[model samples]
Target: MIEVVSLIDAAPPRVFDLELDMDVHAGSLPGSQETATTSTGRRQLALGDEVTFHARHLGLNWQMTSRISAYEPPYHFVDEQVRGPFRALRHEHHFEDLGDGGTRMTDRMSIHAPLGPLGAMVTRLLLAPYLSRLLRQRAIHIKRLAENVDRRR
Candidate 1:
């Protein structure tokens, strides 16, 4: 499991809404060429929503489908992969009000590599760190979006 915590300079509800916007994630990460290919067209994702994505990782193209199995509005949400390269993948998002117009966000990811020991070794030596950086970058991107969301309001 890889966990990331971020203090976003935005209200909890604002950050939560931005976090659920799929469009914000498009092209947010470097070199992934990420795109939601199926089960989408909605403005924001909710419980039971599934999105299939295609991206390039580790020099290979991959496709994964994830379902929002759990959602609790401006508090928390969980997305689990139904089909993907990994043996298992679950991402949980948690947000709490900071009492100062900001939000404390926690992102927890549980991932399992295929091929057992070899995959585990590779994950520990390479994949985990890479993913950690990727998630942190993603968080920064979302935080910026959330903080600036109401600029036109």
Candidate 2:
């Protein structure tokens, strides 16, 4: 399993609001370039809602569909892999109100490599560290966006 965590300064509601907007949130990722190929039907995300991600990872084109397994407004949301390269993936998005008009946002993800031990070995040797750096960069970008965007408040 591989894990990454980040804290963002923003109100919980604001953070949740931004996260529910899949397109907007995906666009904020550092190395991710995502476009909505299919409509989710509703404007706001809810449990069971399906979102598609067309992304370029490590210069490879990839398509993934994620299903919302849990959703709690102003608190957290969880998305599970419906289809992707990973054998298993569970991503949790959480927000804690700092009480001073700021929120602490966290993202925790656990992934199992698709190729079993061999994949795990490869990830440990190559992907894990790179992914950590990527996630950190993404966190910084998110923090800057949330702080600078007028609508975030």
Candidate 3:
């Protein structure tokens, strides 16, 4: 399990909308080159939508499909991996309005690796920290974009 929190200098709706933008997401990772291939391959993703992403990570090309199993605009959403490397993966996103044109974003991720004990060990000793860094990077990107947009407005 992993959790990340970010404070954005933008309204909840603005932050929420930016988070759902596929292009924004694709460009968030500097070197991963992640792209949405299929399923809701649009600017914004909605409930019940599925998206397939192809990217290079850890010197390996990987693809994963995930579905937006739950969504509540400007509030909360959840995406669950349908087909991916992990045995199970679910990510929950929450947005809270700060009542002052700001928003608090929280991300919680739960992952279950395959191959039993070996995978568990790998997840604990390696994957967890790697994912934490990745998530922090992503959140920082989002925060920059959101704040920049605010500045331009």
Per-prediction tally of clashes: 0, 1, 0
TM-score of each: 0.93, 0.83, 0.94
Q: Who is ahead in TM-score, 1 or 3?
A: 3
Model 3, residue 68: what's the lDDT?
A: 90
> Looking at candidate 1, what is the lDDT of residue 149?
64
Candidate 2: misplaced stretches above 4 Å?
1-7, 149-153
TM-score of 2: 0.83
User: RMSD, each candidate, Å?
Assistant: 1.5, 2.6, 1.4
Pitting candidate 1 against candidate 2, the one with the higher TM-score is: 1
Compose the digit string of candidate 2's lDDT tens values, residues 1-153. 445555666667866887777556576664667654434666467788887778787888878778889988879899898888778778888888888767777777776777888988977887677666665666666677677767533
Which candidate number would show the highest TM-score if scored against the true structure? 3
Tens digits of per-residue lDDT for model 3, 1-153 = 899999998888888888888888898886998988647456689998888889998898988899999999989999999999999999999999989889999999999999999999999998888888888898898898888873554
lDDT of 3 at 77: 94
Task: Give the C-alpha miss distance for residue 128 in model 1, angstroms.
Answer: 1.0
Error of 3 at 137 (Å): 0.8
True-structure Cα RMSD, model 2: 2.6
Sorted on TM-score, highest at the top, how do the candidates line up? Answer: 3, 1, 2
